[model samples]
Target chain A: MKIGYLGPKGTFSEEAVIKYTQGVENCEVVEFNTIPEVINCISNSLCEEAVIPIENSIEGSVNIAVDMLINDANGIMIKGEVIIPISHCLISDAPVEFKDVHCILSHQQAIAQCREYISKKFPNAEIKATDSTAQAVLGVKSKPGVVAIGPERAAVIYGMRIIDRDIQDVKENYTRFLVLSQKDGVVTGKDKTSIVFSVPNVPGSLYNALGVLANKKINMTKIESRPSRKKLGEYVFWVDIEGHREDEIVKSVLEELKGRTDFLKVLGSYPKFK
Target chain B: MKIGYLGPKGTFSEEAVIKYTQGVENCEVVEFNTIPEVINCISNSLCEEAVIPIENSIEGSVNIAVDMLINDANGIMIKGEVIIPISHCLISDAPVEFKDVHCILSHQQAIAQCREYISKKFPNAEIKATDSTAQAVLGVKSKPGVVAIGPERAAVIYGMRIIDRDIQDVKENYTRFLVLSQKDGVVTGKDKTSIVFSVPNVPGSLYNALGVLANKKINMTKIESRPSRKKLGEYVFWVDIEGHREDEIVKSVLEELKGRTDFLKVLGSYPKFK
Candidate 1:
């Protein structure tokens, strides 16, 4: 099996793929520069599956991934999910002291996660944003007085030293990555079905659509609103409910939602990550 | 009156401040580097009011601004809102052709917005991410073969020329900005109230909470979920209802919501921008 992930081999997405397919043998992992590319690869059959971060504990939704999964990758389905605890390390090529470092580099999200620590410790350092934390690690490999905040795996992958460990402001940071494949998972006793739907732009329309789930006593785990990408003030709701799509109640709720909503798409039914 | 906005002078936030306070004399506009800083300036009385981008047509919500308004800046209230049409321009110091540009710089959001345009026009250019589009304009001022994607105002402010105009991929891109003041706005008859609340982590908790508003026939304009920042799977919902908080129906809805949620914070009631 071939698994594609957003990577330069040291991203949290790569780490997620590793942990998710830990026991699987003969797995070939490929790296893509962006989330959309990973999804594109999945759709193009360049890879059998793709792993992408769906949500962060601090940052609500990974909009690019969610939007792509909803709009671009039509046939791909989420098969599983992995939760990885995020721990950012300040890495450098040389034995540089904290005060001597003149520049810091990382992805925008990583920089945001470590905002407070960076501002306090390296107020004078020039912050450079990169495409990915792993890319930052690669960029800073031969540069002195420059550090990259990335996963510890990045430091190892790029042959750099960790100048500081666990520098993120929030200690409880965790990212949820979804495993996407051409096939959706079969009904697991404990499963979650993810769907995206848009209600007509009328008063009480969203409430009426959500009532379909509430009326059937179905429990929704998450609900998020994203721009429908068609126009301003237009939105589509992404929801996760605690049941397989094959379940009778879940099927009925989806059928009722289909009738009520302007548009509805079932992304997938996957085993719940405990 | 002093108005604060996210700035290096050329951000959409600055434009929002200008449009939102149009025709007002003796208004001093101050610029802050980050959204939180702008909010802090308002809370600390450094500025009488602050304008920050709340949402985008393409991007769902400005999480930093929303999070700060919900968690950090107490006693601050939203006073008004302004909608700005975002038109990104490819700017440069010299009159260079698109083919001559070797590097492109912009804020990540701007880069994402103009992804198709940039990739199609300058496929080989190195993409650099900056803190803000204005900052990108500043960074490219002395560099040849480098261009920044920013508001057209930035080109005038920085003495740069627009190499390409309206380079954003989406023609309908618009950003919604909110004005924050120490004092809340009075009922404007046609008003909107924004509130942030966290429902208990139980099945049907959110459904029941929304039931309070639906039962009263109150129309909600927007609903967004942000991480509570305490732990994973915990979120606080931001809802914009179509009425002033002082309205009888709105008041009853809040009272009922307060009883059903674990945490509730009314951001403010303000005149809804049409």
Candidate 2:
């Protein structure tokens, strides 16, 4: 199967795809610039499946990920999810100390993440914002007085040296990405099913729909609502429950869910991100 | 009041602040590059309140916005929300036809939004990525063969001429922002209250919490869950209800909610973004 990712190479998403498809065989990779483009390619038969970000600083695009999947012309499903810890390093073509660096390069967010470190160490260094952190790592060859902030994997991919590690202020940084495919993943026994549904504009209506899971003692992982956009004061709720769509209880709940709301779209059943 | 925004000027966040504070009195706007820093400023007394993007291509930093708010030391609240329609215009120092363009500049996402237009009309034009669309507009000083894609307000702010309008692939483009302040907004007759709470590791714990709202006949607008991040297999649920916290029914719901959950944090009550 061919796997697609958001990339120009040496990105964290590439690492995520690698980590996810580690044991899977016969995988070819395709890259797309935007989330909608990457997911749209799925329904158009450009590739069998792909990995896209739902939340993460690397992508920092949660809403579009959810919005596109909701509005995509073709049906897309979540197959799996991976949470990649964001570890930014000061990567350089050669080892250098903070004083030796005259310029710094990275994506705007990356630079901002290490803003305190940069201002203290390289107070006069020039800061250049690239299209992506990987772009900064790729462009690090020509500047002797420059260091790029990006994933340590980027340094290895570009054959660069790591000047420092974990330069970002937030040590608990992480990005969660979803594996997208034409159909949801097979029952992993431990899976999460995501669904979108709307209800009448009255009290207890949503509570009634949620009762299906509550009745069966299912653990709900997430529930979010976005404007319906078609009309004023209307909303559509997206939910994540702790069971695959194919699971016995989940299947029965979905069937019952159909009758409880205006419409129900079972987005996908995927393995939870560990 | 002093308001904070993500900026270097001529960006969408600036426009959001302007649009949101249109009828308000005595507002000063301060600019910050990062969401955490901007929100942190509120606690530090750098600014009274701020507008930050929750969703939009211009400020594709939704995760940071949500994450920062959930953990902000200052106990920030959502005072209001505004949805800005994204309308990109091709602007330059002087008007230039598609044929006359030698290069196009904008934030990568803005350029991608107009991807099909460029691929069809200016296939050979050099697509340069800048720190932001505003930076692209600012740098258009000598590049007569260049045009930048950004909000039409950029053209007005930068004194540039717009050569083309609405060249993006999607027409229903909109960015949602939240009005953030130290205290929750006033008791507007029509309001939304947002809260974050957790329940014990029991089957119907979450459902029972919902019962409080249902029993009060509150219309819930949004519900989202995020990892409490403090432990494994634990989550914190963020919810939005249709009535102000001060409202009788909603107040009763919160009082009952306190007894039914692990902990509850009333993020804030704010005027609904209409």
Candidate 3:
């Protein structure tokens, strides 16, 4: 399998790509700059599969990944999912006491993930933003008085020593990554389907639309709304329902929903990843 | 008004706090470690108000901000929102060419946001994550061959020159900050209400609950689902509807919903920020 993911290396995205392809031999890892790029690569047939972090247990949803699927309704399905546990580390090249470090560098999400520890230990150090924790480690390695907060694996890859480990504010910080492909690789009859839709800017519209799913006794796993850029008083909704598109009930629900909204698209239908 | 937010200074959270509290005189900015801490500070009378980023245009949503409101439902209400445009810059201590830099640092979101730009311009540099962009700037400020991607303000504050500016991959990147207060801040009469609820695990339960709101002609601005921890199969939902709790229609909708769901709580009823 040729797998593409968001990475230069040592990123959570890279780790997820590895985990998802663990059973496959002769796997080719193609790194991209963003989730969308990976999706595009898969959509364009550049790679057989792509991995994107859909949501972090702590950070919620990654809209870009969802939006990419919504915008491109060309048969891409989520073949699998991987829940990767997150562990942030404080890394630096200097061996001086941690108190001597005057700045903490990391990605904003990492900062948020490790907020509690940083606040208690380095209350006064200037907090700096960087593109990634791996990059921050490089900055620290090249500097004399800086510390970087990232994953332990990132520290190892960047040749930096871990000054502190497991520093995330929450112990259960895990990211859910989706493995997408242009074609469905395998099917478990009991699968899930994702769809995006927009209804009229009037009351009762969404209720009427959701009625289709309710009437058919289908289970909805998730639903969220984002502002529609086309008009000010409009919104686009993303929904995850627990049934395959090929199912009789799901087909009926989609048929009924077609009449209730101005636009609707089934993002994908694939077997649920355990 | 005295203000509190999540910050150590120079974080996007601090930027959001400053943006949302625009033009308010004698506003003291207090920094806290967590979203709950910010709300607690406001609730305990340590700060008159608090501002936190509730969502991003690119990132979809801020889950912590949402969870904080559910837990601290009685004490705080979202008063207003700030849509701040985000721009990334590569800051370095020495005016070295972009190719001369061996590593780049930024917040994880920053890395995600500027994915394309970094891959195209400095594809070989190891990207590191940091706590915040400001910290990344500080790292690059002492390192001659490293670059940090952050807001332009950080470059100015840390005396690092910009090797490149406006490097974000997305042109429409924006973070939505919410202004929250213990009181409703004189309800504008026209307001929206937010609520969290848990329904029975049976199929069509959410649809039935939403049907009441639809039947009452109430429009939902947003809806999202998160796992409710107490039960294995149960789920909790967060919803935003276009009406005040005092409104007759919304009141009736809540009455109908209460009859169906096992648990429900009104998060707030503040005038919607335009």
A67-132: candidate 2 lDDT, tens digit per residue: 777666577888888877788898889767777898787865566567667767886675665556
The TM-score ranking, best first, is: 1, 2, 3
What's the TM-score of each model vs. the native? Answer: 0.96, 0.78, 0.74
lDDT per residue for candidate 2 within B169-219, as digits (tens), equals 666667777888888888989999988888987777878899899987788
Chain A TM-score, each candidate: 0.94, 0.78, 0.86
The DockQ figures for the candidates are: 0.63, 0.31, 0.29
What ranking of all candidate models by lDDT puts the best one first? Answer: 1, 2, 3
- Give the Cα error of residue B16 in candidate 3, in Å: 9.9
Which candidate's DockQ is highest? 1
What lDDT tens digits, residue by residue, belong to model 1 across residues B1-274? 9999888898878888889878999999998876678888878999998998888888778777787888864699988989989999989998887778998888777887787787689876777766678988998878999999999998899899887888787788998989999877899899999999999887778888988988888888888888877787778899899899999989989998989999898888999887
lDDT of 3 at A55: 64
Q: Residue-wise lDDT of candidate 3 within A149-255, one digit each (tens)?
A: 87787778878888877887667677777788876534478788878999877777887888888877788876666546333235688888887777778888888
Per-chain TM-score, chain A, candidate 1: 0.94
Q: What is the C-alpha lDDT of each candidate?
A: 0.86, 0.76, 0.74
True contacts kept of 3: 0.34
Which runs of model 3 end up more than 4 angstroms from their true locations? A8-11, A73-75, A91-97, A101-109, A124-164, A229-234, B1-41, B50-64, B79-179, B185-188, B200-202, B224-236, B259-263
Task: Give DockQ: model 2.
Answer: 0.31
Cα lDDT tens digits for candidate 3, B37-150: 877787788887888777655445556567667666455776665567777887889889866888888766677667668778887776665656676777775677788888
Residue B79, model 3, lDDT = 64
Q: What's the count of clashing pairs in each model shown?
A: 0, 1, 36
- Which pairs, if any, clash in model 1? none
